[model samples]
Target: MAAGTATTAPTPEPAGRRLLRGKSWLATVPLLLFFLIGFGLPAVAIVTGAFTVSSDAETGAGSFTTANVTDSVQGAYWTALLSSIKLSALTALIGTAVGVPIAQAVLTSRFRMLREAVLTASGVLANFGGLPLAFAFVATLGNAGELTKLFHLTDHGWSLYSFTGLTVAYLYFLVPLMVLTITPALEGLRVQWREAAQNNRATGLQYWRHVALPILFPSLLGGFVLLFGSAFAAYATAAAMVGATVPLISRQIADALSGNVLVGQGNLALALSLDMIIVAVLVMAVYLPLQRRSARWLS
Candidate 1:
């Protein structure tokens, strides 16, 4: 009300509010420390070890170089990396193909309980991977197993240890994961769009081909890449089912890190881990944009 003075903004915020803000930030300290200990430290070790020479005399601070990285991707390791990529790409595509329809059906269902049941099942099956899943598959389809005996699979010649078999096993979990992810995206597909297409004399197939598929494409592709990363990083099931015969990069990384091999194995393993990290980063980079776009509709 003073002529020459201007009103203050209530001291911006009270001391108590400032203190609460500090406390809120302070609450994250434990989580930050946990991340530093659990992830940060390991990441540092991997990065350093990837570039650090194995036999340096400095002990604590070894000589740094990129020699390990170059060696990590050569010879057998290169083959393994390619193999892993192939396996992941194939399985992810297959999973998307299998999962999209199921998700769409769930999204379009009239019954809420049926939708809930399917989603609940998908969630359970998605996490039902690893060694246990492999073992179950083997028990049902392995040589002299129940299915092998009942269906006389030996006469039909279905070997469960091969690449095709591993793919089938991977599909068991991957499909359900796709179902869960794509369901939300499918739900984002508006009935209005379909009705509009129908109003314009478009058939269901034409609607999907022209409008629905285009809208859903980015989300579908992103899900495929997510599945790829999931399958790429998986170890326990692949290790249990196919072992070293599969020529997977994850298995090789484990072998290098297991301390059972050459002196430079640690550096090799770290380099491999760094490569995997880079790949996952690239995948996520593509995914983030598509995610933002897809989220626009859902939001």
Candidate 2:
């Protein structure tokens, strides 16, 4: 019998492609480490701190109790929770209003130069949070601020320590995030889709309603949820804007820790517990809808 030629099965992928696939694990390592260090540690600390009660002045015991959580849920706690929900909802609404237009303007336009500038500004503005950022706004619009003085609106016209002022400061951050999130969704609107809609004689509003809005709504809602959650927990910015006029959850938490509250360090534990509960609920509420929307968009 003649010898049969040897046969070999083809490789699943080329060697070069396999090499890149194998290296994908490297990309995931940093993200895993980040979640472990940044998120994991703080979560553990908070849980431990909240449950374990204090014994001596500065020390806490290993035991657990529900008293802290119960005590922290009354009076000022209830008020702060309501204020947080209201403020966050308002911020999300405002962010959506301002961001949608800016995103639409940028994505639909052919101005490359302007797009870069707008994107850069959006990145900076989106990250403008915390105390320093708050102070920057204060310096520009506060009673003694430069622009306030120049515009002659500081003395008898406007007050920056009011809820309205806090809303504005929150908007400064929320708008940028909305722009960043929604711009991508807008850009993803395959040109063919728009052209096809136009070819069918659809008006701008009609096109948006039937095509654009559905596509962009997921991103818009996701961005709004993120900004809402951030605004809810926002400590430094609102604190600077309201000072003593408006009481926010973060400020109360601070008070608990720094002796501003009469309950001493117990209040700190209680406040932390409240913070944990509020954050957990907010996260779940926002995440569920966002996750659903994201899955819908993907499918």
Show model 1 residue runs off by greater than 4 Å: 1-38, 56-61
Clash totals, every prediction: 0, 0
In the range 144-182, model 1's lDDT, one tens digit per residue, is 679999999989868888888889999999999999888
Global CA lDDT computed for model 2: 0.76
Score candidate 1 by TM-score against the native. 0.86
Report each candidate's C-alpha RMSD, comma-separated, in the order given: 4.2, 4.2
Candidate closest to the true structure, highest lDDT: 1
Error of model 2, residue 67, in angstroms:
1.5
TM-score list, all predictions: 0.86, 0.81
- What TM-score would candidate 2 get against the native? 0.81
The best candidate in terms of TM-score: 1
